[model samples]
Target chain A: MESGNLRCGRRLITSETGRGEVVKIEGRISFLGEVNPKEGKLYDGRSIKGKVLIAEGAKGSTVGAYVIYALKYYGNQPLAIIFEEETDPIVVSGCVMAGITHGDMFGKLDLRDGDVVDVWEEDGKLCLGISKTPP
Target chain B: MHLTREEERMLKGEYGEAMRIAMEIVVKVGEVLGADKLVDISHAHASGVSYGTIGEPGLHWLRELSSKGAKARVYSTVNPIGMDLDDPNKIPVGEQFYKKQMEVLQAFKDMGFEISVTCTPYYLRKPKPFERLSWGESSAVAFANSVLGSFTNREGGPLAVASAITGKTYHAGLQVLENRRTTHLIVHPELDDPVEWSALGYLVGEKVGSGIPRYPKPPQDEESMKLMLAASAASGGIALSVLEKVTPRGTYDIGDEERVEIDEKEIEELFRFNDPELIFHGCPHSNLNELKKINEIIKDKVSREFWIATSPKVFDEALREGIIQSLENKGIKVVKGTCSVVTPIERLGYKRIMTTSAKTYFYLNRKGLEVALVRVRDLWRVVT
Candidate 1:
């Protein structure tokens, strides 16, 4: 994780996260609003071609999984998902159970939009800790 | 926070052979979330009944564990049972819809739960708020926790029942109220109608993400509280986030002036919808007046098959009044316990779904279904 690799109390195969220049996501840790952007017209107008979404579980939509699954199946899934609160256990459970690793968002990782994030996986673990890019 | 001897035995597999594995899974889930002791859950509502296209092994493991006589030693509620149809009237339009309903129900009955088909079990049999209840309806959970002020976590499928039987839930999120203190979302709004409030909620769910939104005040009454809770639940799949001012512990920070702020510009943009085949409601089950309002609103405009799901109790009331039949005569199907979301889209005979509720809209969008959205009261207006 460009930010920091925090997975299950640091007990997984090491070097399992991605290494890249930092991307700081400047967004509120909302226990409201929603996570799945595809469900609303709120999706980016131009292209979310490389932007990584940092959210817990999506709000209001059972299709959260469907949208994520579709995006992943088509290679448009978020860079990673960080959860401050337990949104839907299924979100992480499904991702993990399916081997689709979205790096963990844990322990007060404040993210804002346009924060360049780098992600990857190793030994059944994914990481995406964030840091502010160079001003 | 102490465990009973019976619970301890269940943990160690003394009850049923399956309890050993099931209880262990519960214990592990709790341990991961740092729950202290087991809490008795009177009834539970569950989800894993639908065979997932996501995890086959997890599905298989659940099926096998359930097959081994894994009854939840406590009363439980589950998702709507799918019925097997012989004909569109024999069951409904398609066999697949009915079959899925049947399979889901059969799985529950096989596991020892007396199946009741209604989304609002509270209406059928209201579990007193704060009574330990294990439920899974996203909107229902919020209603239970925030509206009714109950004690429950979103029993994560059947395993949640295992935790309930053993009386142990991972004390991570919803179970712990203090962890529910407001995160203070500064809502900057400009409207206060139901439709506006609904859209504001959608925006809040989007902007707030996963932290509980703390307002400066609470909704004025049950009606306003209802809207706020609906929006909060919709944005947070788990539902039941504390409304800063109205909730028992959350209101202190939110004085009399605390409330939800609406971004009319954002809401105007968000409320836009394309042509929709159907307008659906009752994902969390509508209260009496809401149902009546629906009945009155669609008295004229409900030209297609409309669905408004509720508990059997509500369904019965409608049946007695002939409201259900009246709607049926008008192309609306007022069913019990089943909502349009869970029914196969094909079964509903519509490729596009539309709604005012952010929660419903999100699901439709997620499924790649064409959805036209309007706010709640607006939906009533649109239907009429």
Candidate 2:
């Protein structure tokens, strides 16, 4: 197991903080079609409930913000959303309205799914602390 | 980020609670994107109005905003909803669905939006060259930037609303003149058919991702450009496409960069004729010329379950020109305020849908519906 401090680009939604296992999507996600908001499930049937979701970024419909909101409404929202690339307007607005923890991390971390990560704010800057854990 | 005294007043809740919240959203987005200041926009178009797309939570948020006295501070417009507003019965949705969709539209209307209910706002009011806008519809964002030589970053639904309320957006992305040029070049095939143009757009979008693609001799006609740009925005996150001799000079620049060539075979391979239950048009809302062409083709003899989805404003114009009645007489349903992409067509009992729009084909297929692509000229075969 690997553990280290991860730097965050900016804190988008500081209303909430989260610490949980990571569910990493290697590519960008189109929350509108790729996500089933009612179930908080991705296209491949993975549940994002309570996990710290890591993705490249978001794409597709501008309505994707609502899909992100639905995840919160259905009680299956991720603990936090960490984008390897910079976050787009859709995901930022979604996390803002949904009160979910969202931030951009620099580069790709040598992290995998089920890695325990803590996403929080320190002195108005977003911070991440990771402790690798297995499923 | 620097805010004007008036902008600071709004942020401090001097304008209103809604205006404060809106200003916060704009400022936050600007800070995230590293903008120097906010730019006053001429227009703002918000998407995510469709009930089927946004669902229950979206409706609640919108209603909440409307209740908080969030009104448009600029010339704001809204995208299509889940059902036809003029004739709710046109779409095959249950009573509850109908009511919810109406409430969604009402929320936006209450906020003083024009309810343009279209992805093609350019048709209603053509943006002048270099006009700054904050628009949500990806296709319209691409069209306005690439075709009309306007400036707008492809905004998300909420960001657009915030811009509308604040009458400003973060001055970054396409709004900045220096970022408008692209080194990526697409050697487009010579094609006259709008369907082929759409296909080219889809292919280019897939290859280009978010980068702008400049063409040497791109299609100049409005219809061709519309289909191509819409398809590109659908498949790829392209907001600006530079075309030589078409786009106004000085809005964008071209650099000697990577070149990708598209062949006739690639474009031709996308076309397929199929027995679709519904033959739909106006994915971006049919312009007067498109309506006139469809009217000339049908000529009072329609043989299939056809639907022409358009904005209410365009429908009124077509009605005045006698094209709407002629198409209606031939049993073609000219639905307004909704389209196949945003509407839940699967629940409406439509399985196989066919259209000439690559945007429609891409989005409908994403929704798990069988979509067939054909040319605009060949639409007659499907209609008959």
Candidate 3:
């Protein structure tokens, strides 16, 4: 397993760990404009349900927070969210409201799309363990 | 993070579940942002009220908070909703959508939030300099920080709601004096027109994302500054911009900030546009002056839809001054409680939209609507 240390995260809602396949969007995502919470689909038509979503950070409208909440309401939320840099208020607030496991990896994590990953907090730090073989 | 006795009590559920949850959200966000203490705020303005924007989940969350006996502890106002609360026929959304939208509105009302229904809350209640505020709308936050010299981080909807319930926010980011220092300097060419000022702001915001930019010669009037601040925030996520003469002195220090220059050619290119099916104004909600100017320009009825979005307060002022009647006589539609940015314009079947505000153009483009940037003075020519 390929492992990486988390730079920052705070456990807000649920302390349960998350494990799922990975899906990475390269740049900042606007949850409101680019995501369809009803269908669990991204603008590029990728299903984010039960996947570990990683991106640079969130951008665009503040309504993005509600869109993320809608994702959870529709039972289409990601297993967890890992960001390269610090997350915006919309993303952080949504994760807190939806009980989604999230962390800022400080760009150290090098896992790719379709990789199986387990995300959890251990010893006050969020830890990510990625499987070697692609799913 | 240090919490006072009262804050601690609220967090510990002594104040009730609503206040407890609100304090928890504030404390959690403060911890995430590395805030050491919570600051008392004079006012809080909540955004993300639009049903088109927030959808069912937002409605659910607000209803839950209201049902739990949540009320605003501080003086609070709300942003615009999805449909025009005054007239349902103005927007194409059906009665079912209207009913859901009203339920959301009722939730806010039940929570003791003032039905301001405006993105530009600064116009309704002018915030004093050095006053701490918790405001959610991007344009309002930018204006509050940059124009009014009030302290506020660009908070999200949830945080703003929490702040309203608690009357406090984490003392971090723009609230702290050190973080407000300008890191970049942008020298703008002579720009008298409001549209040019907006374009310049858009360009500068794109070039310097999230950085506090200082303008050597900022817009002199409130209307121009409003346009600039709104455009900058929409384009770059900029919460603050230090104006040379306008911003209060000693609030920000420019310690060897990187410098850049914006010229007339760049501003000219922002006005490029073809024929538009609709002309929109007031992305940040037009002030009384802008409405009066439009009243003078449109002498006769035009063919295309000329829409002006403004706050209910401003609309009342316009109505009192007979400006609304003059505009309506010329077939201009005044929309309150909503604008092109937050409303679902794609459902309206309007393909092309033209506006003087760069912020409006940027957001509409993101919503997959065709938008063109046009000058306010030249909009009449295109519509006619």
* CAPRI-style grade of the A/B interface in model 3: medium
Considering summed lDDT, which 10 consecutive residues are worst modelled in model 3 chain B?
A: B268-277
Predicted structure 1: lDDT? 0.53
Candidate 2 wrong stretches, greater than 4 Å: A1-9, A18-30, A33-36, A39-51, A54-60, A106-119, A130-135
Can you write out model 3's per-residue Cα lDDT over B168-238, one digit (the tens) per residue? 99999999999888888998788887888888889888988889999988889988888998998988979
* lDDT by residue for model 1 (B1-384), tens: 355687688767787766765565555445445678666677776654443221233234445557776766777666553321222342253555454445555656666765665545565566664576767665556667765667666555545545534444555566665654555455655455554555565667676655566554445545445555566666654355555444555322322223445555767775665666777766555666667666776656465445666666666677787777766776666656555555555444577776656666666677777765566656645554
> What value does the interface RMSD of model 3 take?
1.7
Clashes of each: 48, 0, 0
Ranking by DockQ: 2, 3, 1
Candidate 2 chain A least-lDDT 10 residues: A1-10
Instruction: Score every model by TM-score.
Output: 0.67, 0.91, 0.92
Q: Which candidate's lDDT is highest? A: 2
Q: Is candidate 2 or candidate 3 better by DockQ?
A: 2
Write one digit per residue (lDDT tens) for candidate 2, span B262-351: 888878777876688999888888888988988887765778889888898988998998888888888999999788888888887888
Model 2, global lDDT: 0.85
